[model samples]
Target: MTTAAHPLVVRARQLATGLLGPHAERVDQEGVPASHVKALKGSGLLGVNAPTEYGGAAAPPAVARDTAEILAGACCSTWFVLTQHYTPVKLLASTELPVRERLLGPLARGELLSGIAYAHVRAFPRVPVRATPERGGWRFDGTVPWYTGWTLNDVMLLAGVSEAGEVVFAFTEAREQPGLRPTAPMRLAALSAAHTVSLELNGLWLPRDSIVLRTPQTKFAQVDRPRNTNASPAVFGVAYAALDLLEAAPEAKETAGSLRSRLDEARREAYALWDHPVPHERIEERLAWKLRAHDLLRTTTTAALVAGGGRSMALGSRAQRLAREAMFLLVQGQTAEVRQAHLGHLSEIP
Candidate 1:
């Protein structure tokens, strides 16, 4: 339902080609500068799917997926930092709360960039973080093992399990203050430029009004379980980027073409399943398509490196950078169910 020329999608294209692609190699080494984020904010691609009432594009899923693919292909680090903004937008759109009126407009208008910290809740039994009810608010403790765009984020949607078996997600300024402190950025295989960090929350407290979603664990899992079943559109973006590198080498064009044909089919299946209204339906098919996308991403990236031969070993080689980025994408947003499915598939022998 989204057109290629959707203003937001076109903006994403312009950002990717004009800024992200050219400086990606340097950014990969020097870290994503604030200037790159400034460009994203200027593009308004940050609110590609936010409600139009807030001056967002309110574009369709097609536009969202298209822009994701284009931005990720150019620079996954910048794409990742911006990607965190959409989840908060989606969550706010569904809930009628004081926070919605307070935050949605700026977030949707790209005036504020938010980061996500709730994925840790996916590790349910462990409850890595906890929120204990206090007088006017809740006290958050324990550690958030993974938070991307740490210092670059203006706000973060932090989550912790409560004594009543509810997951409490609240928003707060993203910085070291009170009981919230962030460790140094992690050294990672890829997208290190996104500035990943771990947060130690000793007694961080937010007023009850700052709370967004406080749903029972069961309901949260039901919705969260299927989110990663289908391969993310970013997977296709990185996969095709590798394919582009491979195709550039005349000797590898035939192989790249064959892989591209297969990737196309897998993308179709994965995206079709993503568009299904029922989130819990056809999960097996969704996981299968996810696995297929991961497989193609690995194969395509590896093929690119092989085609580049020794030149791929250079730090500046696009082939090398794409390969490492592909590695990170394969595991990013991985869930226990998805992990089991992927490991189970890999364990099978010919």
Candidate 2:
């Protein structure tokens, strides 16, 4: 029997098709105009995963995943910016940190937009950002290699490695504050619309109350490994969009039909493994499906560009945009383990 669609999922799909898709190209060129951010804030998608007690839908995991696919397919740059908020919300909800009560209500109600500055923590062996104990709380020092949603987000969840060897995460304003300075947004190969930058934290300080989560580095990795195995929803969304483009062209219809079947197969297996009851079980199968989905994404996007011919090379073309987005997905969530596995898979090819 077919299940009824979730309301939040339906809302996300509507926003994707009606608002995000039409303006994606322009936003990519101009770097996420303010109007788009305004619309997103009003869309209520920012609170999709927030607790219902905080005026949010508290959507199911599948609802969250499905909305991601819709949003990313419509405008990846927008999707990338908004996606960062979910992690911080998840952290706050699970922790008893004081910030949870103050921020969760506002964040969940879409009163504030959030960004992330914790990816640098994934750089094991080398601590990119450092935290030292101080009077009121902790002092942060070092460079954040990448910080997205610079000008747009109201707050950020920043991370650092502490002297005690624990990973500490805290919340701070997402702008140039007393000890935090952001470089001009980087001109990236793609997703420049997200307005990414490098942040220099000379002696940034946050009160102990700002701290959200603190755990041994080992514990952090234990949690991150399984997450790294799942394929990003954006990959599936973009591949589906490209397939849609291909199907529109008479000569490419058959090619699109074949790729569609493969894409659906990969998507099903990937999501099933992703939504498993156990968080870390079937990890090997998850990675296999992730690689398979990645391959199909590459193939589907490449076919669209090929089908579009010389015109596809133009910056104004959707084919060109999707092609560049596919390239971004290749390394979007790259971890050392993922890179090693992906490379090993490539090396095995005859």
Candidate 3:
């Protein structure tokens, strides 16, 4: 039996096909297309998850998930940047009124596009990007590698260390600043079209007003717990796409069936978690649900590749691209080892 699409999800699918479909392949190779991002702005999709008070749709999490999955199925690179921007905005939506007034409206209206640059590498000193007190606001100096969609965004949600040694988020707009420079884009196995860039700040001055939110102590139990809900929907789309591709291969039928079943189970568990209180003791259990979702996606895509033989890995193939984008599922937020440890902790949480 086929599932019926919600009106909003139906709209998202139509928009993806009409505007983003023609350029999806090029976007995968060229990074986020500036024109495509602009077109999305015109479509009023940029504000899909924004609160209506700020001129946003105030889309529910499930609706947002459906939208993202549809978009990702059409173009993984575009959806990657789009989802990254939306996630930060979702966090911003939960902030104070002043912060929303200063940032959200412009963000939703697409007058401002934003990106995130968080520290992810292991060898990198876990030092927060230092922000020193200044006359009017603060002066920031540090580097953030892998700032996704840098070229396309007018603003960035930069995570840095404050003078007080707190992890702070600063909204830095791109302007004619002397110190800010974008480095050469990094070549990657997949999602190259997302235009991820490294940023260098040479004693950049940001007014105190630029500080949007600060977390003196981040409640990871709350923060990390719901992190996957938004992205999970898009993952579902990727799995669906892989399954669609695998349908042409006779050997892939069994693998595809298994993947579909696992995906359905993960979706049920994830939505259930969204409704219920996630106990601190079950943090690992929650993580397990997310990991299982990740594995099912990976396995489904891998099976597609294997079933297709040499053709699937050819340059410019969608299968190859999906495989590469799927890697993000593995490395994002937490590493495999970290996730495994959390799962172990959850098992012992009796």
Candidate 4:
């Protein structure tokens, strides 16, 4: 059922348009049904960014980005669940740790799914999670405020700051274990179907081999800067979906036309900056494009909702769903600098 021309892309588009898009509303209400995840596993898109030697598609960066755009536009909850798997794959591929041999193959093959409990590390000075040297490994203690894919993941990439100010990351069983506790999944304004939870680690320990990365916290910051500055392609995808809705209505054609033109312009600029040879160049321009894209996203989604008239008020309406997703993307991968810039930009509006 797959074609030779970009098989992974072709498959992802088919899954997005068929299984994911048709069932998104129900999946959102049900918090990502099991059948949907099973379809995703068979799609082979989960391994898009992993190394080919490890059974991943090993698609190009642009291919991965386009796949994300398609999936997020179809069903963000499902996209988020799978997105967490890529980071650990990247970490394992980059690190020379012994655990790489143990986990990378299975994860890349989609035989196992992983979630991230590492965002708390971004709260640097606060030290939300801390690691102390122990006999055979390291002991982790403190709280993780946001851990998505709770019961759905097989493992998690957990991170904490060491007493010596180093960032330590390790893979651990995602289930409840001694000294590790998880709160029930949270309900949010959007993407609640992702099954997010908070984790509390009290003397949780991981063997030395399980530890994937350990470097000075400053080094992590250096690697993290360029990533946070880039615009997410999902922003463009979701905005386009709303534009599609607006385009269907005769009255909103002109508004949709103008926003579509602006969206394409900003998207090209953002993608070009993101793909530049230098990883850290033109960060300011990248952020500018990000804000511009977000503005367009807001305008398009709101217009879609307005154009839907009284029907938009229904909980299952695409216009309503897209509107809520727009809210979620506004802060999905937020950093302190991005937050400051976004808020500052809003404050300047006369």
Candidate 5:
């Protein structure tokens, strides 16, 4: 893994072990501070997948995933906040839009961090957020149910469905503006430190220049559907952290060894399917991998809690925190199709 890990991934591991892990418990209760964000910026870890010309590593997918595991395992709250930035970077880099020149460099250089308000686009027919064209720009109206990294992000790549059934994606400042209102961050079962919020957009207008990518809603689904079936690297990271806890507790060391062997084999198979040349191919196989990761993540984190005994009940304990995080990951990025498939597939297992 080290040989596959780029210098950026190495830097991520150092930051995670040195800083993020030490203070993860504190931040889990308090919130990911500006200092944590600053460290990410300074370390240049923020641009692992961005273009090298814009001060990024542009590293391979495995390298990116390796860094993801390190950071997410060390401090999921902070990792949650940073993960939002990558989508915008990737989208901008792929497009030749006017906004590309304006924002891609700053984002890739780690000078700017962005969040996503675009998940709502998944509710295709409902259109929680709508985009209508105007003379000056596109006007966005409606509510975004879940927007992560609220105050910490400099900008957000917001998406809305237009009348013509196109997915309208545009950039806007993360701060509250004339038509953008952010609700106070909600306390969650986990990752409350990431500052999650809901946004109301009555008339948020972004100039045409701010527009990044647009495609038919159906086409968007075509591209997005397969992406969610893969196991997230962060799942393994947290599972590994749980395994670490078990390894440290002398009684659970034997169990930890067995789980580690299974976990490694599961990860190898899952990632192989994830890297398949045709993403839409082997759909069932991918979902099976997703379930396996979730199963291991749940099992490992719960085992960690068991190893901690009564002390694990403490709100500040890493065991309890990891358990809560495991709950969050189960539904993270879940789509209706994914949900149905995951659950329906589970019932047939018996």
Candidate 6:
């Protein structure tokens, strides 16, 4: 069945299809192709989620999902980079007007590409590569182990632990800063065009005015609040895309059917929650959505490989890259136990 096509989805499909010959391999290797980036910027497609005030298409979360799914079908690396920029733009939109004017405008216009340096090993909390203060600014230090689109980004949303043990998000220009250093890009099994690398920030000082938002105590609570509905559609879209890939494989009939049925169930549950008046209940619902989405994609992709008699692992195949990219969803947040607990709650939801 043809998915209901939005205008953005149509345009994205056209762009993805047109660029496939030239960009498909590059995106698989580089994570995101330069040509793809240029095209997306020139076409103003990157701003689909940016607010109208910032000269963006200001499309809904569903548009973002559709766009991502379309792009992923052609180039997973580009979709990865696009999602990185899109999420930060959504976060920026929630900030004060001055911050929006200063950062969001250029970002929405596609003149700027961005990355995030947020992850750190849990054992070394003090070793987090970036940190900001409670009241105003931040003093960033440490390094992010895996920073995607580092070379292509004009800016980055650097996150670090604060003095008070809170998490802070700081926006910084990539080129101007001497302290923020990018290492050579790493070779990955897939999503090569993403330009993933390590980042080092030593004694980087950002003033209070540069601070976008901070979450005290639990960082997840502040940034990924229960009410943040912007990410659900994107998660759904990625799962749908992976499922679409599986469905196209003759060996994947049974697997695809099972995955699609599960996804439809989860989608219905999520949409029902969305339509309800429960304000903070969405946090759990989003977690559930991500968990189920990840499971469906992982299971379907793995099943497709087995059913395809190993031909799916050939170079330049969509299934090959998707198999590698599927691993990303497993490492996202919380732990196995936490995910299980969340799953229990989700399972219990009538």
TM-score of each: 0.98, 0.98, 0.86, 0.97, 0.97, 0.80
lDDT of all predictions: 0.90, 0.89, 0.70, 0.88, 0.91, 0.67
Q: How accurate is candidate 3 locally (lDDT)?
A: 0.70
- Tens-place lDDT per residue, model 3, 1-350, is 12226566777788777866666666777667778778667656678889888777776667777788888878878887776678567767987736667889888876777787654322123653566667887776777666788667788876666655455667777543766787887787777688877778778777767777666424422454455332366677787888877877787777778778878888788656655564433555556677667777788788778877898767667777778778765665664445565467557755
Q: Comparing candidate 2 with candidate 6, which one achieves the higher TM-score?
A: 2
For 1-350, candidate 1 gives per-residue lDDT tens digits of 34687887888888888999999999898788988888888788878878889878888888889899999999999899999999898888888988999998999888889999998898988799999999889999999999999878899998999988999999999889999999989988898899999999999989988888899988998998788887898899999999988888999989999999999999998989989999899999999999999999999999999999999999898989999999999889988889898999999835
Evaluated with lDDT, which candidate comes out highest? Answer: 5
lDDT tens per residue, model 2, 65-163: 888999899999999998998998888889887999989988888889899998888897699999887897989999999998998999999999997
RMSD of each: 1.0, 1.3, 4.0, 1.9, 1.3, 4.5
Q: Rank the candidates by lDDT, best first.
A: 5, 1, 2, 4, 3, 6
Q: Per-residue lDDT of 1-350 in model 4, one digit per residue for the tens?
A: 32235778788789989899999888878888777778877788878888999999888778888888888889888888988888999999898889999999888888888999888777787799999889889999999999999888999999999888999999999999997999988999899999999999999989999999999998898788888788887888789889989999999999999999999999899989889999878888988888888888899999999999999999899999999999999998788989999998778867
Worst 10 residues of 4 by lDDT: 1-10
Please give the RMSD of candidate 4 to the true structure: 1.9
Q: Alpha-carbon error at 46 in model 5, in Å?
A: 1.6
Q: Relative to the unseen true structure, what is the C-alpha lDDT of residue 62 in candidate 3, on a scale of 0 to 100?
A: 71
Candidate 5 segments whose C-alpha is farther than 4 A from its true place? 1-5, 348-350
Model 4: per-residue Cα lDDT at residue 118:
85
Worst 10 residues of 3 by lDDT: 119-128
